[model samples]
Target: MDTTALEFSLPNAAAEPDPFSIADLSPEIRFAVLFFQRDHYCTNCREQVQAVADRVDAFRARGAEPVSVVPEPLDRVEQWQAEYDLPYPLLADEDAAVGDAYDQPVRFGLLGSVSDFLGRMPQIVVLDRSGGEGDPEVVYTYSSNSTFDRPSIDELLATLDDLAADGETTSTDG
Candidate 1:
């Protein structure tokens, strides 16, 4: 997918209509790692988020910030964050527009007949913001076809290292 063309208006607890664009977030974050999850109630989703929470320091060390996007209401987003002790912001994609933007799978091909079913498969996006202003550039995009498909924490950390080696720098200024 052409991530540079991506745009979303999800809500954070403290802000309404928070854009994924790094330029809009203060302190000029160097990178934005967006994690798209199926639902907050899923055990695997909780585990995946916990993994991200555990390695958040590693991401921050590499000048990247991790944000989670879920197809839940703002209340649920906030509740889930507190319940799981998530270390980063979780955006409320209630309409699933962001999910559609990231091309999340909606149905299993053979199981398409499942009643009222909608695929909320998970995925991760790593955006390089060191490009300096304007829209952030997507350096990595991982979309999972199944519930169990997710990049390991090690793999994500290594990707952050690679981006840093490629000259992505974290910002300490507001």
Candidate 2:
């Protein structure tokens, strides 16, 4: 069975308020973000982040805003923005609070010891415009060890299409 076909459990809404809920954003559009570690960088992470940023317009065309969230400092984010030539905002989650909210965890199991810990895998999350309080659907997910088989840009676009086709109007800000 393909991992892509597996349904991911939504985050517990009561666990904590979504970081996006605190932002003053447009309620007319859906929101999505590629969450990543702040200081730790990996070639695969860079590739995945760039891929999403490059094709964000495709999401916008479908009435969604795509962004990248990292646990980096403002200066580092600016450097990355210039280096990557990012078009959308690159958020700074300084304390990894956002990452924690997303259930990102660094596991030492694979390394055989706590000293050999590796960062959490990359993940993409989609949020409905209207915040009614509950888990938002996880349209796509891939483990850190499974980066080689991560979905392509086309595949992600298709997934978004399927998610939007469900005929449910995302909640709206009243």
Candidate 3:
């Protein structure tokens, strides 16, 4: 999928919340690090979400809001969030529409297809909306075929830091 072309709208994990659209986030958020995750059944996915939750402050310091996107219903999504004590938003992409837009991988074969039906494969996308307007630029993107695959926290932080630095330089040059 074309990262530049995709836009998204998923229900935020918050109670009685409205749909969180990428357009709505773009203007205010310097960066939105979206974690496209499979269902809670995937232990690695759960761990990955927790890892991001652990460093929520660090990401906030860098002007990035890390939000997890799960392919589950709102009720289940809320249950998972409360159960895990996740600090960040876990948007419900129930139909996997957002997942499909981002081209998050899906397993093949019968069992794989069952997994696919349950949810999407794991991936991470960092959108630089500091520029603001239009579709926020895709500063970074990573997809994994296996459940165990995920980028280290250090790597994610470095990418955000690098993007922040680049933004600073660009703004100052103007």
Q: Tell me the spans in candidate 3 whose CA falls farther than 4 Å from its real position.
A: 15-17, 26-28, 109-114, 117-119, 167-174
lDDT per residue as tens, model 1, 67-86: 88888888888887677777
Per-residue alpha-carbon lDDT of candidate 3 for residues 1-174, written as tens digits (9 for 90 to 100): 354636766778752235776666534558888888888577888888878888989888887888888888888788777877777778988887788777677777557546664435788878777654566777677877677778788888888888887743211100
Report clash pairs, candidate 3. none
Off by over 4 Å in 2: 1-22, 37-40, 109-117, 130-143, 146-149, 167-174
Write the number of the candidate with greater TM-score, choosing between 1 and 3: 3
Q: 47, model 1: CA deviation in Å?
A: 0.8
Q: Highest TM-score among the candidates is held by which one?
A: 3
Q: How many residue pairs clash in each candidate?
A: 1, 2, 0
Q: How accurate is candidate 3 locally (lDDT)?
A: 0.74
Clashing pairs in 1: 106-119
Q: Looking at candidate 1, what is the lDDT of residue 169?
A: 32
lDDT for residue 124 in candidate 3, whole number 0-100 = 84
Name the Cα RMSD for model 3. Answer: 5.5
Ten-residue stretch with the least lDDT total in model 1:
165-174
Please, what is the TM-score per model?
Answer: 0.80, 0.66, 0.83
